[model samples]
Target: MQGPVVTARSARPTVMTDGARRHLFNDRTVARYRHSLSEGVDRVAERISGADRPFTGMSPQRLAPEIAAIDLDQPLGDPSAALDELETVYLRDAVYFHHPRYLAHLNCPVVIPALLGEAVLSAVNSSLDTWDQSAGGTLIERRLIDWTAGRIGFGVDADGVFTSGGSQSNLQALLLAREEALTAAPAGSQLPSDRTELLPKLRIFASAAGHFSVQKSAKLLGLAPDAVITVETGADRRMRPEALERELARCRREGLPVMAVVATAGTTDFGTIDPLPAIADLCEQAGAWFHVDAAYGCGLLVSPTRRHLLEGIERARSVTVDYHKSFFQPVSSSALIVADAASLRHATYHADYLNPARMVEQRIPNQVDKSLQTTRRFDALKLWLTLRIMGADAVGALFDEVVDRAAAAHDLLAADPRFEVVTRSHLSTVVFRYLPAAGQDHERADGANLYAREALAASGEAVVAGTKVDGRHYLKFTLLNPETTLADIAQVLDLLAAHAEHHLAADERRLVRR
Candidate 1:
């Protein structure tokens, strides 16, 4: 109506200047990308090579101010300059998990093949949600899922999706179980059709030693506050089947529906695996969904000699595995595998613009349909590359080495007069504490142990973890690094003992002065 509102094309300069254009990653900037990445890699390599200990003892109080002082609004412009700034803020004091003395958590030193896969995946930037977006990425992830399911002894109906970590995997597994419980109300049971009315009656049974994520997942699923029933564990820290049987009976008598029974394949602190065979039998009798959080003990799946440790895991409805923990992959590589593929439909939702219901009918494989996350990374590439290059047996051997190291460490602590070890783990964790003089009271011992952990961390000599066992403070050595030898464990133990002794002596002097 306004005469077509014609506009003239002006000869204006583009906003993307040559310098800014050079910063972009494209066909033309391949050399720049390679050079920049090489510089960053060199810096990391230098840090790893120079680090004498696992940590620099950089406390938050000291490092926080240094980080907060930086003017992030001011860009360095050059990648090398930014990397140099990173060295001061991050690389210099970063916890080097590759260090043999880093006996803290389930962090494993990554393999080269996985690192290579990381580089490629980051560059490609594939979002593994739909077939159109990911193409081969979808297939690769599916293949990996199939391979993992096969290893898990899941039949042809098995399916799964990669997740951010173990927590998310566990959360999704419980979510699926919750949905199943709601829909498949027992033949004569009184489960309300409305979710709100029935949600309060649902209960999850997990061992006292199981990961806290179970409780967290239950909360997130809108279950009651006391929804998670803690089943007692034996002296070995494994879930007692007898205790579970009694709990199941109690739940039945109380008219509470057993939604899921979570079994820990490898717990966080003690690394003790629950009695899977017995737990599986109990879950079957109770008609509860069986889930195995094999985040730490998933290595046993590949272990040539120790595969029997996970005897009844094949019967689990769902399982969580963290490749980062035992397979030596990089951080944030984990999966949730389910024996029945149909259960994944609980997580699927069709969006018209994205994965429409028609896509499924058309046989278009969209990973988002089965995943909790819509925009997932191509993390499967790392494990794929690792398997292709090193093979599963090689990865399992590395895990075996650490398991052996942990067993040796347990023996070392058991024989030591200055230390007291807890239950021996079938996996790779040893919980112990430095014992002071026999005259010291429990309070003094606890204070000394706490003081020693803090002091040792402050000294930058080594890094270890602390946990409470039976209301008493204890130290934990989660041995995931295969390079950590018995000598390294002995040295760290000596350091801890010295620090504890120093604390006790200082305390005694203070008492005498008082």
Candidate 2:
């Protein structure tokens, strides 16, 4: 009987008073959403803190099939109930990368401050392409470019733009290098219609151990990926200077244009660093573009201890740096920097809406003049906020921490007779695998290690990655977490070694059964 007081329409929406066509989201709704978000975050933090148990493995897929069965029709019921189902169905199975033991990839443990900056950035939705849209955001991003360039030793003339990540940065570097290569060609000979005839038998050079990205960049630039002349490496896994010089001589004699020489500050798979200073001299002597892909290793710039590792980085005409990789910034914080901002003129194009030729006359600093993207993200904010909060020295020290921790992990694993380290630890990766003493050979030991790793992941233990090093298999630990203690690494190794031993013994038992 009390329920009879209910009105036909329970309540009026506040936005309707202003004669606005109704939006599902109103100011009050947004306020509620913010509160809900805060609540959810607090709950997550508490859940993590409440955990008395350690993570066992991260095997990737353990969800019920019904949850993932997709039908595109819009839901017709209470939305909150549907969302709850989805959280358990989909998100529950997702790898918790932030879990301290999930030490698999280059993706770092993102800092809390950077996450806060990102929330504000997503709301503003400023495109960095135009100063009109971005305003203060543009200035902040430019300052970051300047600060990074100065670290690379590119004085006065250095300028760069924030990119999506290393791949995009590499593409832009090669684009500029291609533009520089055709310097003497007819004015019209450029990308969008790069005059093919003007293009020489252009060659790029890099170490054999350089990331596949260097070759990929070459392919994207209209050169065959295989056309990149490979230089043999010495025992340290660095590009041999003599082999590089010999190749340069051969290219010159064959009337091929030597366009660029790429040097890796830290290679992807093995963490190998090509000898930069020696490579720099070769590039200078050959009059080739010296492009350094320091995407993984550029953080060394701020590291007082490791700064010397990248001594010749300044000689690079252009460089790629991924702040996300080692700077503890969120993902997609990468930059492509050139020694002279004028080099960016090559990437400049004219469209009625974008960087019109008239704007160039006014000397307006349109980011579109240098960027590969029309609609780009404001990725610079996270890195800018991070650097500002921690200072250069602190960030550098964190990188030092990664390298040091990785070395300690290597020492710990090496001390155990059960682990066969394929390569001595370098950078932040330790390449090794469990080795059983008697029953199995090297091949079977590798198999056991691989299976052991899978079992570890399947059991929700610790996630460790595997890779081939020098034609042999290995279990690799790529550390980006500065807080990852030696004890943490030791526990994972011990678990892995124990698992491999059990598996090996089982294999031996199976053979005896046969």
Candidate 3:
């Protein structure tokens, strides 16, 4: 009897009840979750502040073993414990984009207001597809879209929808353009009854330096790979208006319909803005849809001192703006605005259970009517929160700061004999490459610069991007961080030079051995 006596024990998690739903209405459980989230945010903030480098470069060969050790199939039971493990597995080796030395790519250090919006929107779980799902979120998103259209000086009929990013925006814009072209075709001309028949005659024109998304969009839209016409660019890397005109004429002569003329507000590699006015004029004359991919340069919309850079953007039939890039907001914030809101009707697909035509007639604004996405995230809130707190002018000032910093970096690189810099930056990117000794061959110089970039990234002291300009490897410093300074650029340049020297000497040693 004494041996049979049992002791008190803690209760285990039960499988009899809905474990997921149990936490939903429980204040204690939510409080615990909140605490865990707060702890996680603090841990990340502390880790970033304490970090010495932008990244801890762990090659896949080395990282594989470490990643293999993690048993992702098992859950930790407690959020804090899970977060601690995540810190070891992810946060430790993660690239700190906020770090001044992180000069790679278009990633920017986000503003605090946007982060707050992210938290709120995540908690609320607003699906912005319909008014029934998102309620005020749909309205807020529409308001933000309207504000952006106004900034672009679009007409009263202008309208837009939030997209995942610039790529999605560009895709949706081209889809609309494709539909418009089909609708405008002459009565007896080669208007196809079938989808495949239209692929050959439809062409899109963009500068050589334009984002790769244009070509990718063509392929995705069932157009042939050669459907994208690469317009020649000037020495400054801006798309040449005369070249575009000739290409448009050639398309006309060949009986190929120019579906769209995609002008660049900001080319990715060179940060070049094309001759938008001339391009827009030509597109108007040719009866082609004018689309401005302003994903990189849309920040000029709010730029008080530099807004003139986007003088002819208002004439665009469609425009893409990535707030995530230029607005310093968090990722997943972009919009596709059209000069004529009626064009969005092309994307409208009404589901009986969701946004039906009756709802539209009743004046219930469902975003799905205009959006390519159904269950879309409320990314517009990020920019809304950003503009609300920071003010548009403040955001523009921040952009101005980085752009001015880019000019300074360009100057520094231009003056340095050890590096060969491209033309002055039109935005916050400086493309340059390490110049080996004067007598070195182009291949050797390319090898040095390529090796130097890898070495710099491997060292974790600095992170820079690389591109092939004119088939020669060139290193790039995408200066998106406003806090990054001339001194920081100097240090990065010095490190790059040191790495280039090492690679150059190693090459010499290899030649000697041979």
Candidate 4:
């Protein structure tokens, strides 16, 4: 007796009965996966080509109801239908970072090769925690870390792990510093055997212009309210080494152990780099761990012309680099690299079922041993592919172009009587404010600048960031897109000026009515 033939048509009913079996990514569904991804790519490309600006200025109040209406429990079943629904809820109003006019934040336009890596990694779904889970992935990430450490001028002892972003990197770096401080405390001197008791006396020194993550990390580490001591910045917005020296001396006199001295390589608003060589000297004298938060300025590591800007970064005990910010990789591509590989042992925890002591004895590699996260994504693949396809020099060239563009934008703002430019940046950000008129008071100017930023976003012509400078409102343009031209900067400035003037006129009319 011959068995009934099992054809492709008969397998469809079984798959449909199982409901989601057909969607599983396997050899049998390879064609479906390819088709689905191609459809998505087409939709995104179409959206990008049609977009005229960086944003549609869609507000939460308007879009929230549309999203809430969707019943997630009810599957659309067809990929095409779900994508169509996505168009209305997401794709339509999504902020297009790739657009040249997106000057809002540290978000950079992604590169194609990195995007390719992203697709591949997501499909593979490899967890980077253990060698068994991500064999080649673990080695790939380690190699990329070594490559980055070499760029930062670290020696063979360097090691690191990929992180979600700069904040996590900073947190992990500080955690290591905290441990080192507790373990290395002097013999007698008021330092208690209980590390928890000493946490309050551990001080972290950072520039006033430094990232807020320093304070947040301290809180997460269970430090006192005043653990993060803010050192004043100079006229250039860089941390004043003289002020830092004074603070360190005061901490020493008070018997407060200096846990770390964080130097900013690229401040968020000012884009100024703290004097690294001077700060490194101070850290060494104080016996404090030196950590450089080069999240925004890490691009200079590969920069062909601006590498000199990050001169003292190599001296740091640990450094944070966000490839997403400077290297044009996608979101969540950052690393915390250390000068001494053994320091990462501070983050290690051996799980019996996972990375046990026996595995370490066998010399098995596990990324979780050096990471704050256990189930980490293989984000290093993005940077690997990016470097493989574009080369370091090409990436550096793109960053150099943006820095040159920023300098030109600064000059443009300075020459314009309608605007007041702040201190020039060493990186690729320009901070300025629209000056209403000669007679306008500080309060009115602040209001005008504030109103202009909001109005500009509403108008959807361009998106720019806003920050406070010396208690006054200022507009910021973070130039990460290499495609942005001088003409685009000029046009955005003109629009901002026009909006500010209108705001001032409206205020005058309301005051007259009163």
In model 2, the runs with Cα more than 4 Å from the true position are 1-30, 43-67, 70-72, 75-83, 184-200
Task: Flag regions of model 3 displaced more than 4 Å.
Answer: 1-28, 188-196
Please write out the lDDT profile of model 4 over residues 58-104, one tens digit for every residue: 99999999999999998998999999999999999999999988899
Off by over 4 Å in 1: 1-18
> Between which residue pairs do clashes occur in model 1?
none
lDDT of 3 by residue, 1-514 (tens): 4556444432444463546555563465787668767898999889978989899986778877887997887767677788788887788889998999999899999999999999989888889999999999999999998999999999799999999999999999999999988777777865675556766789999999999999999999888779999999878999999999899899888888889999999888999899899998999999999999999999999998999999899999999999999899889899999989999999999899998889988998889999998999998888889989999999999999999999999999889999998877689989999888877665798889989999888888999999989999999988889999899999999999999989998998999899
Candidates' TM-scores? Answer: 0.98, 0.88, 0.95, 0.96
Model 2, total clashes:
4
On a 0 to 100 scale, what is the lDDT of residue 440 in model 2? 59
Candidate 1's residue-wise lDDT over 1-514, tens digit each? Answer: 5556544433443565656777879999999999999998999888888989988899999999999999988888888889988988999899889999999888999999999999999999999999998999999999999999999999999999999999999999999999999988867676677778889999999999999999999999999999999999989999999999999999999989999999999999899999899999999999999999999999998998899999999999999999999999998899999999999999999999999999888998989999989888999999999999999999999999999999999999999999999999999999999887888865788987898888888888888999999899999999999899999999999999999999889988999999
Residue 122 displacement (Å), model 4: 0.7
Candidates ranked by TM-score, best first? 1, 4, 3, 2
Best by TM-score: 1
TM-score of 2: 0.88
Model 3 TM-score (2 dp): 0.95
Q: Report per-prediction Cα RMSD to one decimal.
A: 1.6, 6.4, 5.2, 3.6
> Candidates ranked by lDDT, best first?
4, 1, 3, 2
